[model samples]
Target chain A: MNKRKVYIFLGFSFAYLAGMFSSDIKSYFIKEVYSTEYGNLVFKCDQAMREHFIAKQVVAAKPNAEHASSLMQAEIALIDCQDYDLARKKLLSFGLNEYDLIELSLRAIEEKSEDIRKVVEIHEIRYD
Target chain B: MKFDTIKPFLCALAVWFVFAYTYEAAYAGLRDNTLIDAGKHFIYSTSLTPIDPNIKKASLGSKLFEDVRLSFNGKMSCALCHIDKFGSSDGLRNSIGIGGEGEGSERLDSDGLVVPRNSLPLWGRGESDFQTFFWDGKVEKEGGKVRSQFGDYAPSNDPLTVAIHLPFVEIREMVNDDYEVKSSLKTESVKSAEKIYDRLLERVKENQEYVSAFDELYFLKLDEIEFIHIADAIKVFIQSKFRLQKTRFEKYVKQESVLSPDEVAGGLIFFGKGKCVSCHSGRHFTDFKYHSIPFVQAGFGKNGFGVDYGRFNVTHDPDDLYKFRTPPLTNVEKTAPYGHSGSALTMEEAVIYHFDPLRLISTENMTPLERSEFYKKLLASSEDSELIPYLDDDEVDTLILFLKTLSYEESSE
Candidate 1:
């Protein structure tokens, strides 16, 4: 095909693809806020239930040596929203202490953050 | 001097011949030596690991396990088919669940719906290695997520917990298949399953004993409780109660135990020439994968026309047709009749049926329809199948003996 014809075909393909996935793309850009209330959470009921179950499991887990409750609550927060920022805030609100540095490292590791490799060393350097 | 030297040389030559002949005969007598090497090979192939479950929660879960209220009809429980006496299976060629009375053989007389496949034993299912569940592997942990009939909305992250949702909601198994019953449960969506779970939770909570017990056990506020909680608890319970104990095979692997000559030979045949390890590999005695072996159809299958297209029922892919999950064989001797149909009466029969299914199927007994249906099953299973190597009678006996070494007596109490 000539460049003019190729451009026309590509334009149509782009339009079709965008039209097909407009809602999915919209959903991804928006920060997901799941609710336990049935009406609000209807479509994502399964996700809400799974989050709640994870919360229960966190609560049931054996306590670590120090700052365990805060760590546990952090884990629950993460399960609820899976938003690291939100979970970190929740953890801080629960009162981060000696476990904060390590707990943060755990979350960073779980999320596979680019800064994860030196997390433990950084924590020790900061705290020690 | 010459005569003396010749005599000595002849005597030495005669002694060496006799010694060589005796050594060959001794080697013939100790044919079981190969079996020891086979045992070593078997040990190299499989490893056994034990699990730790929350004792308090598992105890509470045990109560829920036997509670008949788990079913919508109040007719069935997990215990109905997974009887302790029958190697944690129903001891039927095919399970007859719901609308059934009595246990084992007497269940046949009931007006219950016959679930097409044989009741699978729960042995080694609680193990982490046993990542998939059910005959078709509808609920499986794959690609770092639980996949199931629930699709994107699988009830839980844990596949076993997700698998727990199936039995109670299944129409023919736990819920009555009647139109009224179906309508009562609402439509067959993930929402429909949630609605049933909600109702079942209410029913469970209504029992004061369960309410107090669960409240104390899970340390939960009453409203926080849900059906997946029940599933999780039962999952823990199964894990705790059925964790791999030191089987004779495990002990033999560790060099802390010994196998009889027959058992060693059988173990050899299983791991080596038998080719069973091709499908039934690893610690759980399963690769936790699916393959077709042309098992005979029993009762009405999941699909009408006396035909069930196994994994195809789940995936609808032509390649997956006639495939069933290779079942773990931890306690094979007791969990008979074997095969997906429970068609093989004895372990020997089950082993033999792998190679020669026609030997087990009584042509005289099968109706024209059954025979035709079975032939269709054969055709579907013929291509790209798990290879079932031929076993002689002694080898079959030895295999059964080896299987017995995998079992240990259990106390539900």
Candidate 2:
């Protein structure tokens, strides 16, 4: 009813809308304009989600899926066989570049030792 | 007085139009993006999208699923272990497939060959994203690459198709553990698997019913047919029959249904204070990753003396010692006798084991050998178990109520 109150209401509405859109604008700008190839792959994977089934069917150590595990197995095998060339071949065959094996989680035994459940909890705590 | 009354009517009309315009605009905006965005999230969270089952393929698979010819012994069927009435699992701590008779616990009376591991339920096994199979996770997908016992000689690219190749030839599963069966089928080596596959193929081809079904599905001659064809059909059947159903929780999430206050409270604790969402994430309530929660070992155990190395036996890596997959929680209430060995008798017992495995295990019950083995398991899993917080009586009850919300009746005929 009064001009002052109406002005105050308008200002609060503007602030509320701004606060909401600020997150959207930042995400849009980073993902669409800047992050490019990296941000392009947000959800195009099952990744390690299906990496936990046991098979007594047959034993094949093909470099498939779960790059970390495959590469780790290959690395351990490489240490024994000392066959870098074969390891390199297996890497390419499994659709992994040799450089991908260099990831610290794959290299450092204990670095990736944090339990998966704990990691998820830590993520929520840090971000949520 | 007439002017005042007319003015009030005009003001009311203006207010009505303004409210109508604003409501329409807001709804339009929601429809264009917000609604779709929310819907996408709901689908992702529940993954309850029903997949259509191919009638002919599934029928063929259903027949083969109950076929004794799939086994070398000509006695056991896949149904012996994976009975549909038992939530696609035999309600036994250990399955008695090869020399076993009767159903459920009745099989325990037979001098049947006992399988080492508990029969895993076939709930969402053939879902497009369900790439893991077995208690040990021997067949699994990593970075889009599927790995199994087949090594470099994997039969199919899809893990489910490859995974289906196991049960028929596995000792005490479908294949009887005998010198004759072993020598005839070469059941140990992968080639023996192929040998048995050819025999099963011939049996199917000889049948007019199966031959016609295969011909209808693939437009193939008997000569052109392969075991992978059989595997794929069975996979399609599993995808159709055990397909994901929309749970009450999914409906509640979509704002299409209501939940009791207890379920809501349970859900809050599940994702919030309980930390269940850490491993039991997504629509399946599993991340499909492995963990060592220190459940008591039961049955003969994978390694004997009530010991199973679990994932460590699969890879032989010290890091993977005592780990098992975080099982999906669909119809978890029905698929009882939990753990890889069916050690926990109830869901409450299973949940309690995660935080306090020793509480359930009495030192008096275990043998001297079992005691040492359990200590080793406890030592290995103690650190991993500590990562999760303890759930008290009320919290565990609410969690079980929330779990009940995940149970649903399949509409499949």
- Model 2 chain B scores worst on lDDT over the 10 consecutive residues at B30-39
What tens digits encode model 2's per-residue C-alpha lDDT throughout B76-162?
Answer: 788778877777889888778787888899899997888878888888887887888887789987787779888878898899998
Candidate 1, position A94, lDDT? 41
- Residue pairs clashing, model 1: none
Off by over 4 Å in 1: A1-128, B1-50, B184-186, B364-369, B384-386, B409-413
For each of the candidates, give the backbone clash count: 0, 22
* Model 2 alpha-carbon drift over 4 Å, by segment: A1-128, B1-50, B183-187, B410-413
Q: Write the per-residue lDDT of candidate 1 for residues B93-186, one digit (tens) a residue.
A: 8899888877899899989888878888776677776779998998899888998989899878888888877988887788888887666665
Native contacts recovered by model 2: 0.00
